[model samples]
Target: HDVTADDVRLAHREGYVSVEHLKRYTTLGMATDQGKMGNIIGIALMAEALGREIPEVGTTTFRPPYTPVSIGALRGRSVGSHFRPLRRTPLHDWNLVQGGTMTEAGLWQRPWYFAQNGESLAEAYVRETATTRRSVGLCDVTSLGKIAVQGPDATVFLNRVYSNAFAKLPIGKARYGIMLRDDGIVMDDGTTWRLSETDYFMTTTTAHAAPVMAWLEELLQTRWPDLKVHVTSVSEQWAGIAVAGPRSREVLEAVVSDPTIVSNEAFPFMGVIETHLTGEIPCRIARISFSGELAYEIYVASDYGPAAMDLVWGIARPMDGCLYGLEALGAMRIEKGHVTAAELDGRVTIEDAGLGRMASTKKSYIGSTLRQRPELMREDRPRLVGVFPEDRGETFNAGSILCAADNVAGLGEGWITGVTHSPELGHWIGLGFIAGGHGAWYGKTVIAADPVRKGNVAVEIVSPHMIDPDGERLHG
Candidate 1:
């Protein structure tokens, strides 16, 4: 039966004032189909009853699924075979053959780990991490966001967007840059490689690919219309593989046409090279490391990705190389005290994240003025630091509140954001924030109270760099 006009009047008289409240109270549009037919009628009735025009009364905001449709229609031809709309890397099929434990990251289906028979998920990830630290390991990093910036004003455009200086960066060099929000919080961190005098390749975190592209477009089209800069997203056009560890050069030398291209003397760390593999497969390589170890990220065209992946695997197998996944990737970053979206979450300022020095003073960039607000530079702000369980065997939960050991009754000093067990350090380490930074609590013991998980642990505050404080391993 249709909803009668009286239902609307009764709902109003009962004090269900707001349109949303009235709708829910009367169950006016709560049908399985969300009342595609009855919504307008109900709105009209309410407006009439309220002695106001329809616009004055207003209607519920229309959302998705405009009209009722079957799931079958949405699925269309992409039934079981392609239901997930997954973006697979070139070695996706080969990873399956190697017993990869697949996981979804954004729209891409990435391997979480390559588990061996009789190995649990944790064991597999730990083993992969240990192997990479000891020898060589490769990870498919194709999901990273890529953008091609070409034009005479490309340098100027980048200089305006990033906090660090990039206009003077020479060709064949890569610089790590961090972009901040208009309100001074970090937006994203990535490496921008200077391909030539007028062109550069920018890489962003995978989750920010689309938004960052939109940001650049807005800046160019709305703000700097006359700037000779053209930006295009090329994440799909390029496939990336990060070769990390001490023996990375050895494995890369075998697959690349010129072994000298990757030599330390010719291609120093943070160097970029445009070249081809032995089979004439075109590629671009950047010497960068996320794992605190010597590493190189190799990028090839989409069509040649599969063959390149296979070739690298073939060469790496004989050279004691292993395939690792996201679990190991995260742990390695934690050990190195690096921050991703997890630590740079939109609310914190650059100084709070321990990246204040990266923001330049001599030159202007986005968020430069806003970042200097006196309130943001307070010494008591929650600053990034490493915490370790006192017992070494105990572990605290992520999101656990931190408090002074003697003042457990207080609100909180800060909270743990990330946790990981370091295979190299042989203990559980964490990245967290505290109100009074290094100067205040440099070696003091604090309590990590995890109310949600019903647990607590005594932790020692230390510098975020839990391993290789001098970065000797990374430079190796």
Candidate 2:
């Protein structure tokens, strides 16, 4: 309390890992989530500590979302139809015309399938699964969370909050980061793209966009409130169309970009840049593909959605780029070993998501104390792991019991959180948590039983990363 802001800046220049820590030790940006409040003022003091001018120290950027919006405000009127932004396929209105039912797959609300008379959810899901597997069926992915984080402080805020480093990421480049609770558990995973040295855009789990944005603000405005930053949920301002399959890219090439448009090199994997589509509409295009192929996240003004979907489908139709439903995506991700909200939820830790390397040691942050507890540090803490059935007709339901055999045979070891009948793998596969995750248990056998699924089944424990076993697909 006796020390001045200049003293705090001096301590930081000497080597503080994060501005949040600088706030605690020197009280720099502790002005609520408006970190820049103190940051601007703090930097001035920091300059004084170094005998430099305020201009020499610099200032925060003008990012989007000038202030924090309440979770309630963001939710607004679409409590149900609007609880989330609805995903519509080129034929979505047609499906509604045919009395089809819809549900969410990731952030996209895709039609489960067309029912004849009295088909249950299970029946609908099975039919939808078959339709995509055999032939081509359309699914909507517009609901997938897409956000635009702008301003100079964009990269600055991203680097401090994420467990991974992103300060040096080049423009048009994207990086993956896992959000961690102070105890070093996985909270959320998302992709961030550096649009410019000062501007960054990121996407989080559809369910976590609000909270993650809030968390970012809390850091910039509160703990490290001096940092300049802005975050906006443009999830609805723009829409995303994901057309997957072996032919997705070829079909897309059919809808050629207008002249003066940046080519593939300008927006490669994790590439982020602004461009005009069809030679008119201004859009932000990111070379981000989640379909496990050469894909692009096409962003356009809300007004251009109908045209965008039609143009994309027109291209895909000839190449057999079936709009694989959410079901297929789920199957694809599970087989690829990626973890989603259903599997890792907020209750999970960084260890479970296989991201212990993201934590920063240079400075302390929220939950820093709880993260270091011995119990949490233990290698085996019900880490998120993949499971494969051992015998014939073996599959477990969500929340099914998991028992460790031979290796962690002490008691009921863990439980399955996400289960789906894999069309690709044929055998029922699952993602679940198990105690004693380290050592022999890493490759040991665990029995997963679901009373709802005709009893218990045996599954093998494996790493959470199911796709790109070697990171070939992501980089390629």
Candidate 3:
């Protein structure tokens, strides 16, 4: 290929003046030699075109292995399954002993479902979901990213990072919060529990755990150095298990040293308590429910995790409770229309995820101004909604394109992000995003067109809160 300064000048004339943009616009640094010969010439040309010194137009960032390296050099030992490390929770072996089928969640091998008496995946999860709703269920939640934010200015730090108000979050309580990227897209959503006046515990999704921690550190170190705050990852320090269901309180009452503290009046929903489990094992319990059931998440030191699981399982098992896993967890969240990684994908805005109300109007936070960009606030943008197969027994997969019943071609209105058999509704259900949201399509039939899979099914658009719209079970 011929190299020329004319190409750089053309890119600059086209408004791709930044070195990064110039390189991309004109392929300045993408030669076989990796720009060693022509990148400088291109920069000088770009700078000349703008009538600026060469230093004024900064150089493009260089990526390493300056010279090309062989594939064998990069793959010294790690390859195939060993390429990435695997993480196991303290209850990993216990789940296997109880017939849990494992699946990957990021680097962690979490139980997908617990099969009993040779039940299929669907049968097992259905049983697990039903049993949990009817009684108690325990799930390993240790993979969630745990960060301990403590300092004199921790409250101020949290209030600015989160889109919602956190300064007024009372001590001994937990509040759901969402953070946004500088570009105004939702970065992550999780719950933060205030342990004391200056101490707070935050949880992030398993896949985002590391990134969220790094993001926080970057903000404190680079953006808000004046703030006196320290954030540390405590994910490995604590092993967490969620005890959920209508009978969740009953199960906790049996395990906690003081039954009174686990009561509805004493503990209350979203309340946090530092208490001891059976045998006086110290633990932190938070009243939170991802399954939309009255539930509590108990956290114990990593070393005490196995013993804590044993104690909780012993009591829950005898009470007809079962151990649920990721599959059931997904089904439950879908039933309640809760958003997860599937919906919080970087492309979505807070409002697109049906969480606009969580964005505080009283105070400005990260992404506050940019989120108001006209393009993001457009009413026609795809927003979260519930999807259901028009035929009771029909099933559709996630990633299926949602189109009007009359038009099943092209990208259509929107797409399904997640799908599952709703044991509660006794049919298949899904959570997806569609233009104009549920209000625009409620009671209307649409085509779930999965062209890649060669299937197209008619589906009804409805509110994301397909079950427990009023959250009766969650507060029961």
Best by TM-score: 3
The lDDT leader among the candidates is: 3
lDDT of 1 by residue, 165-275 (tens): 997999999999999877787899999999999999999998788889999999999989999999999998998989988888888899899898788889888999999
Please list the Cα RMSD from the true structure of every candidate, rounded to 1 decimal place: 7.4, 17.9, 9.9
Residues 203-275, candidate 2: write the lDDT tens digits. 7877787777777767767676666677777767766555444444454455545532334454456766666
Ranking by TM-score: 3, 1, 2
Q: Per-residue lDDT for 270-370 in model 3, tens only?
A: 89999899988999999999999999999999989989999999999989999999999999999999999999999999999999998999998999999
Which has the higher lDDT value, candidate number 1 or candidate number 3? 3
Looking at model 2, residue 419 earns an lDDT score of 71
* TM-score of candidate 2 against the unseen true structure: 0.70
Ranking by lDDT: 3, 1, 2
Model 1 weakest lDDT span, ten residues long: 75-84
Count of backbone collisions in candidate 2: 25
How do all models score by TM-score?
0.84, 0.70, 0.85
Which portions of model 1 show Cα errors greater than 4 Å? 1-85, 409-411
